[model samples]
Target chain A: MTPKRKQKLFVILGLVSLAAIAVGLTLYALRSNINLFFSPVQIAAGEAPIERQIRAGGMVKEGTVARDPDSLDVAFTVTDYVDDLEVRYSGILPDLFREGQGVVVVGQLQPDGWLKADQVLARHDENYMPPEVAQALEEAGYSPADYQAKAAEVGERLGAEAVGESGN
Target chain B: MWSFIHKLGSPRWFYAISARLMPWFWVAAALLIAVGSVWGLAFAPADYQQGNSFRIIYVHVPAAFLAQSVFVGMAVAGLVFMVWKIKVADMAAAMMAPLGAAMTFIALFSGAVWGVPTWGTWWMWDARLTSMLILLFLYLGVIALRGAFASRDSGSRAASVLAMVGVINIPIIKYSVDWWYTLHQPASFSVTSRPTMPLEMWAPLLIMVLGFYCFFIAVTLMRTRSEILRRESNKRWVRDLAVEGR
Candidate 1:
């Protein structure tokens, strides 16, 4: 109701609208350039942005990795468990890189849908629980014995799978 | 309508009310965080893939969420201050900037640390990482701008404008994982979508998020009360209260 307040309100309204316009313009201008990584399914659906530097990410399909006999060049297929993409790279892979692991590749996508990767980065699984997080779970109907048992169960399964793998 | 507005806008009135409210928020914060932390760190199953390191999400994601949310809250408060000449709102915004900046740093540090075991690196020039970094700078910029101006009124106004402008980055940071190729993973939490994770994996995270919010509220209330005392020190009531303390 006061004139002084009225003046300040007008200034705020004017500037906020100005800021909104700026954001709208930025979003509109950057529309085509905002290519986040494409998933395997997206790529298979031909939704990947073509001919530009882009990223494709998915799990490395099991047993789909092959290495050259005498070179550093390697080939692998990345899949979303539905569609698959073949990635070829000559660089030394990250230490964590392996078959059946999640990985993201940055490179060019060909018209034929092959990805020539210039770099490969393994997607790390989030795995750490701090003291507080551990404490909270304790109050949430948690039992240490049961948790350890479940972990052991998973370990046993993993060990069995590993043995089966080595036998092959 | 105006009576309620006038009462809330007064520093003295806010100080009294916030004093009453702060205790509950503090208690809730401590309890929620205590529970969230224990659950997230111990009882929650190790990630099928990342194992123990994923537990950092308990702090990392909540801090990141706070970093972005604090910035938005500051901007809204700044807007209220600028438009309505509400000193209380500006005081709240000023108190929040440092906390916001700290949360941004925590998010960045945790993200970097989380990167090593998974991405095999400590830092990347990736989009999500980069935009989040910019969010840090935006917080710092508002803080610095507020301090830069000689006149308090002008300084507050400048900070308000800067906060409004900088808020544009919040959405950019949110969508960066989806909008650009980044080493950072996409959000496990979404408002319009279901969590990609199972209930057990995400329950602790939800608690952490809520705990972080409570922590922010409690801290902001405490600090804003301090600011009120500082700014209104010359006022009769403030001086009377101070003398009464002795």
Candidate 2:
């Protein structure tokens, strides 16, 4: 190749590397802010601001969901296994909202340490199987409860890793 | 090898070759998409949880895949144009920009529709979604930059630089769910691991993804041919072709 063309290629390479470095640094600096929601552990560790609107996400703990028969009020404890955060909502829950499911609640933290949620969103996992397959698995003793437990375990591990990385 | 590269860089050679290849791509795209849509929407069983709304994956996933792939393809084309001074590559990049933008829009729109039923919200400022949105803007920026400059050569250079620089967002988009606590789920398909989805569930999605890729190639080739004709109208071969058509 000619020196001119080689120099042009080098210039392009240099510019791209410079841009990559710039973006990498920017993303690193904004790492905490880039997280969509605080895990129960993060909130418990006081990483989340008090009385400020924020989102907390984790698995809905088994046997922790309570609903009011006469009102739209509901209360549940979201857990990452290491910690738990109680969330209270007064609106219609999503169709997928149930025990042992992952959920993200958006609201402000009260002085009493509970989340008064204005909105609750269900977060689905990557698993996608037909009803028949899921039923077959369930019949084979791999019950939905077991699946939920496994999901909770994964969430707990991910949560712990997130806290560890961001705590620095 | 140098001669082969020069031939490949020639607009006339690309026009001739793509003319022969376009029909095959069009047929593949049509047949694949048609069969995949029917299979995904009608044959595949409903999800145990999301139910019928999960069928949207046939459209959403393919579109999202194409959206990212098209950006990467455009950037590669830009790099070729910049390094080799290949007018064909620049023309192809120019042709690809609008289609890439369209694909990104389709992905975002279909995702929003899917999110409403599954996530209980249409939009969120999550890492994956946010990075995907930036990708759409980057596509628009490249197109706009190309058209803004008075000189076509300058415009092409600017667009190439912008496309190359914008490529950093692609990896971030791919790993956003893993890197951050995003509402978006992690990718189901990965080269390194077994897919979480069953074969019955993912087969149609795979077909749809292939169909989208064929469609992209067919459309880009078609548009690039027109671009070549428009830019090379004064050339003898083009004039002869026009005369022969008459």
Candidate 3:
């Protein structure tokens, strides 16, 4: 290759590398802000600021949803199995919002640590299957319930261990 | 190898070869998309949760895949043009910009429509969505940069540099859902993992993706041939071909 052509190639490579590095640094600096929502664990650990609008996401705890018969008000406990955050909203939830499914709520964090949600969005997982296949899986006792139970059991054990360590 | 590359870089060679290849691509695209659309919309069963709205995946996924793939292809073409001084590569890249932008718009629009039913909102400034939006802007920027300069040589070089630099966004878009807590889900298809979707559902999606790729190639070839003719109109071969048409 001619020296001039080789030099032009090197310049192009250098420019692309410089641009990549710049973008990588920018994304790294904004990593926390780039996340769509904080997890229930992060909120529980007080990483989420109070009195400011923010988003928190986690699985909807099974059997924790309460709905008002006369109003659109609803309350649910969002849990990551390690921690739980209570979310109160007064609007219609998405069609996919249900027990054992992932959800994200946007609202202000009250002084008491509850999320007073103005918006609730359901987070779909990567799994896609036909209705009949899903029904078959449920009938075969291969349901998300088993996974939820295992996660809850692990959470309970971790809590118990923490308590024991505190007693010492 | 050098001679082969030089031959490949020739506009006349590409114009001749693509004329023969274009018909095959057009036919394949038409047949695959026709069969895939029918199978996806009519034959595939509704999702357990999403129901009928899930059928939009047949369109949305293929557009999104092409959107990203076209950007990468454009960047690669830009690199070839810059390194080898291939006018054919630059011409192809120029033709690809609008199509890439169109694909990105289609993906964003279809995704927003799908989001209304499933996520309860039409838009959110999530990582994946935001990065894809940036990709659309990058495509526009490349197109605009190409035409802004007075000299065609400088314009092509400027556009090539921009395309190469903007390609950093492609990986960010692909990995956004996995890296951050976005409302967008991760991809169902993976090279190494077991398929999340059943054959009845994913088969049509695969066909649609292949159809979209063929369509991209066919359209780019058609457009690039016109670009060659317009740019090389003063050359003897082009004038001869023009006269031969008469």
Residue pairs with colliding backbones in model 3 are none
Candidate 3: regions farther than 4 A off? A144-168, B1-4
Could you list the CA RMSD of all candidates, in the order they appear? Answer: 10.2, 2.1, 3.5
- Report the lDDT tens digits of candidate 2 across residue range B76-151: 9998899878899999999999999999999999999999999999999999999999999999999999999999
Lowest summed lDDT window (length 10), candidate 2 chain A: A143-152
Query: What CAPRI grade goes to candidate 3?
Result: medium
**Candidate 1: regions farther than 4 A off:** A1-11, A36-63, A68-73, A78-86, A90-102, A107-118, A124-168, B1-5
Residue lDDT tens for model 3, B78-151 = 99999988899999999999999999999999999999999999899999999999999999999999999999
lDDT of 1 by residue, A1-168 (tens): 589888877877787778878877986786545544676766766667777888887777779999998999999998766568999999888766887567889898989989999988887432333344545666897632232343244335534555565578
All candidates' TM-scores?
0.77, 0.95, 0.94
DockQ of model 3 vs. true complex: 0.77
Q: List iRMS (one decimal) for every candidate.
A: 5.7, 0.8, 0.8
lDDT of 1: 0.81
Relative to the true structure, candidate 3 reaches a TM of 0.94
Q: Say which candidate scores most in DockQ.
A: 2
Highest-scoring model, TM-score: 2
